[model samples]
Target: MTSTFTVLPVPLDHLFSPGDDINSIVIEALSTTRWPDESTGISDGDIIVVTSKVVAKAEGRVVEAASRESVIDQQAERIVAVKHTPRGVTKIVQTSHGLVLAAAGVDASNTEQGTVVLLPVDSDASARQLRDHVIDRTGVAVGVIITDTMGRPWRLGVTDVAIGSSGVHVLDDYTGRHDDFGNTLEMTVVAIADEIASAVDLATGKL
Candidate 1:
């Protein structure tokens, strides 16, 4: 799909206030905020990405770190029959994605004191809901991507990747489409979401 991406900067807002709902807040923002209006630049075939932290906050994933660590310990069974000091003896455990990660991708930064934000309990559901809601209201085939900061095992510096997606092709397979130079692609899964993530990162200071 042909898409023109304008870097819409998000201003500071009083997020995560008591009794605050993200879905409601975003819908309200769309309905009320003149800046994000369809005519003001962004439109169909375009993505609407709100940092996943906002979604976590909206879903009440906020929790005290002390309590959250304890919860993780309980959930972290000795899958490999080995245990070591704190943050040792890695074992991949099934996270929300049904894909295992060393520490369930738990995070401990960018939040209020003594609190850590967790991934949306059901991110796929969250994306689907947001996408469906937008389509219902705008009649536009916009895509939604719930992105989160994650660390790779052997890589430094965090990167944002799609934890969930809807109304868009998450991957653009190029296996059948050989390069003009005649190089046959083999065994590849292009991460389109991460590409968008990195682009937004450049335009937004959030990288």
Candidate 2:
């Protein structure tokens, strides 16, 4: 059978507050949004890419808004690299999650006037909980990915990448696959989670 892929961006109508149940909010959003058809809601094999900001908020991973430098310092384990931009000095640091990212994944945007958001304490666990609760509520087997924005080492702009994933095959291994020329393929593993996260980022924007 032939196969096709689709990524649907679910928009949240309500401003999420700290300690909200993410699963309920997501299910509610799905309930309200008009899908392509009645049967076209979430289903098995569907991948839900949720921004980590919302997940963090729901988990109460936030603090009183502080200066960007201070927030970065608090979250970063060590500075990996730094660049002086016109706005200020930009630092790429290794976060507790072992991710080398800008500002150590501390975000001030889309947050309350006096608060900032942090990465979920354990993104993988967060993803698992979301996946389990969502499946329980809807009876639809779906994958969940918690994503965060990061700047590529050599890229100018930023893109969303998965920090936590659940019920999803994060990698596609094609090490033994054959090529059209009948040659054996090796060392070919695709990072499916990051790709999905990046694709959804285009729709979500930095806001």
Candidate 3:
């Protein structure tokens, strides 16, 4: 791992639509946009963090739904829990993609009226494809992480978490390593991908 890293948001002007090539779009943005330090172009170790919403949109995952609940029901593999709040009923479900998230990863925000966006069919595959595209275009090897917003089980507020990753080690396991104090460590694995996702979210803001 590097001692330091930089987070750069790829500025995009066009709204993503179904059937759009996300790899081309992202590469173009990175190629043309000037960085904060006046640098232009991707580096070898840069990790491209993309919001899953855009990936879903590009994959034609948007669906017209009379109610988001209906779509959630269709996407959910199993209902994990349900809660009745003052606002409405909230369902925590495991999606068909094996992700346990609220509303089965169905998003209704920042989309056309009467439509909601679904999570990518296979986020890991999506990440791999994007990583391949970046390498092919620039001859620079970089990691890719696809993220989605989710509320923690016992935590307040929502944050971005990695749903798919490629060209990156998602976990840093230190289960049998020793600490600085020479004490044997156990269960010290870190979710590096999720941490990167949250950090990128801070830089990019909401999609």
TM-score of each: 0.77, 0.89, 0.94
* lDDT tens per residue, model 3, 47-145: 899999999999999998676788899889899999999998899999878899998988889778889999999999999999998999889998999
Q: How close is candidate 1 to the true structure, as a TM-score?
A: 0.77
Candidate 2, 74-146: lDDT as tens digits: 8899999899989878888998889998778888898988888889899999999988988988898989999
Model 3 pairs whose backbones collide: none
Q: What are the Cα lDDT values of the candidates? A: 0.66, 0.84, 0.89
Instruction: Give the distance in Å from residue 133's predicted Cα in candidate 3 to where it truly belongs.
Output: 1.3
Question: Tens-digit lDDT track for model 1 on 1-207?
Answer: 477556565443555743465655565565543353455533667677767677777777777887765655544544423346685554445563664444555666667888877677777788888888878877778788887765566798867777778776788887766767998887677888877766665555662
For candidate 1, list the clashing residue pairs, or say none.
Answer: none
Evaluate model 3: give its lDDT: 0.89
Of the two candidates 1 and 2, the one with more favorable TM-score, higher being better, is 2
Best by TM-score: 3
Best-to-worst lDDT order: 3, 2, 1
Candidate 2, after superposition: displacement of residue 170 in Å?
0.7
Cα RMSD (angstroms) for every candidate in the order listed: 4.0, 2.1, 1.5
